[model samples]
Target: MIMVTGASGALGSLIAAKLAASGREVVAGTRRPTGSARRVDFDAPDSLAEAFGGVDVLVAVSAGFAEDDVVIARHRAVVEAAANAGVRQVVYTSLTGAGEHMSIAPAHRATERLLAAAPFAVTVLRNGLYAELLSQAAEQAVATGVLTLPLGGGKVAAAAREDLAEAAARVAVEADAQVDNAHRGRVYELVGSEALGGEDLASALSAEHGKEIAYAPLSLGDFRAALTAAGLPPFQVAHTVSVFANVNAGFMGGTESDLPGLLAGAPRRAIDVL
Candidate 1:
């Protein structure tokens, strides 16, 4: 049996639905149990063993959008439970290699280390930032006629969330079928084919709305101040600033990706999505 943790989440739900449609014996692991879905709360480590029981392949969606320590602890608990449950293989959705300098990278790297030390075979899907997220900037630009961000000249290799979910499902299904262990112990850099910058977002918005949208660059300090003024928590403010800092330093885009190779067709155009 294949089980997907965080199955009620945006990404995990897509994976579970795809796997089930493929005629596989799939289990949904969520915090709230409904129907046959198992309660797999990362915060409640004791409940994980039973949640993972009898599952040959486990898809561990990266959790915790809080502080670094909190995220690491949640991942550690899931790893330990998966080990004790005798899961044969684990597929983890992690941050992309290009996002190594982002504040969120540490927790994902910590999770990768934990999974490596476990007994089961592992596949790391280093997914890129979602195009859906980047579209938010475009939406804001359409309203104000100005796309403003701390990403100076840097571009993000953003992939569609649906594409990333599909890739994860494919890897888990192969692992469940024991398909030569080809993906086992492998790390796939699932970034997008096209890299988008602030100007790119402005252009997309201009075309979509038939208006002139301009790109306005904001300094990191100014961005942080705005976020703080909006009453964001300390951890969230820090994480958001770090993401902008990394992007501004040209650390969030890459030339190659394993995304298309794993998918059934070409990746969706990020600009079109925006």
Candidate 2:
């Protein structure tokens, strides 16, 4: 049996539905159980073992967007529960290697270490930045006729979220069927083929909207001040700033990947999602 944690999330829900469509025996693990979904709250560790019981393979989605300590603690609890429940293998969604300089990378790195040391076999899916995130910026640019960001001249190799979800589903199903799993102890870098910059975004917007759009750069200090004035939490502001800094420093774009090999056909273009 295959179990997908964080099933209520966008990526997790896509993976679970794909597995079910393929006729796999899949279970959805969520905090709020609806229909046949099971409650698998990372905050409540005591209930995890029962939630993971009789699971042959566990697809552990990253529990993210929290403080570093909180993220680490939740991952530790999940690891313990999966081990206690006798799960044979675990597949984890992790940050791309290009994001090593980002503020959120440490927790993901720590989780990778924990999974590596676990008793069960593990597969690490190092997913890239989501193109869907850039769609918001595109929309804002279309409205204002200018694409403004702190990215400077840097480019991001953003993959479609649906492509990443499909890759995860395929890996989990293949792992469950293999006697000697080839995916065990392997890390797949799932980055997009094209690296998109500010000008590229403006061009795409212009073509889609049939109007001239321009790219405008913002200084990090001004961006930080705006975020602070907007009443964002200190950690979120810091994390957001870190992403811009990393991208500007050329740490978030790469050409090599295992994404195409995992899929049945060519991966979807980033523009399709935008």
Candidate 3:
């Protein structure tokens, strides 16, 4: 049995569906398992014993937005439980280049460190940015003909979240003679084959929307101001803008990874990933 955390989410649902389709028993882990019949509550320790009791592997799909201590503590507790459960394989979905000193890297890095100490075999999928993450901005840009952001013409090797989910399921559900050994311990930088800058993004938006959606570069200060005006906390705006700045410094791209190799021969196109 494979226990998949965050089963109610988009990524988790995809992972569960794929594994079940392969005739694998998926013990989905969620805060509340009411929606998914194969689910288990992650926050309830008593529930874990039964869920992890006979599971062969654990696919820990992280819940993003740990902008508070409570969230961090809860996340850490789950990691500890996985270790104590004595599961054979532990697979985690993480951001690409997490903890490499970028804005959100610290949190991801901290988790990586904790998970690394686990006695069980582990696989970390350091997935890159998601294309859908930019859809709202792209749509707004299309409406205004201005692709406005703090990005200063740097590249990002982003892939779709669903694609990453599929890869995660493939790793967690299949083990022993079925597991892909190349993914273990090694952080696969699951990058999209194409790397594009802010300007390139604007161009793509313009082409897709059939309008002159041009890039509007802004400094971190201005970006924060814009985000604040748009109703986000100052610190969150700062962190978000800071990440975009890191992208400008070429922090989001990687040349080679086993992700592409793993997804090869599938019925999906890399473009469809968006």
Index of the highest-TM-score prediction: 2
Best by lDDT: 2
Ranking by lDDT: 2, 1, 3
Worst 10 residues of 2 by lDDT: 174-183
lDDT of 3 by residue, 152-187 (tens): 767766677767877887777556235466656766
Clashes of each: 0, 0, 1
lDDT of 1 by residue, 38-147 (tens): 99999999999989999999999989488999999999999999999999999999999988888999999999999999999999999988888766777788889999
Pairs of residues clashing in candidate 1: none
RMSD of each: 1.3, 1.2, 2.9
| lDDT (10s digit) by residue, model 2, range 25-96 | 999999998998899999999999999999999999999688999999999999999999999999999999
User: What TM-score do all the candidates reach, one by one?
Assistant: 0.96, 0.97, 0.85
Query: Which candidate would rank higher by TM-score, 1 or 2?
Result: 2
Q: List the residue pairs that clash in candidate 2.
A: none
Native-referenced Cα lDDT, model 3 = 0.70
Clashes of 2: 0
Best to worst by TM-score, what's the order? 2, 1, 3
Clashing pairs in 3: 99-105
lDDT score, candidate 2, position 107: 96
lDDT of each: 0.90, 0.91, 0.70
Candidate 3 clashes: the total is 1
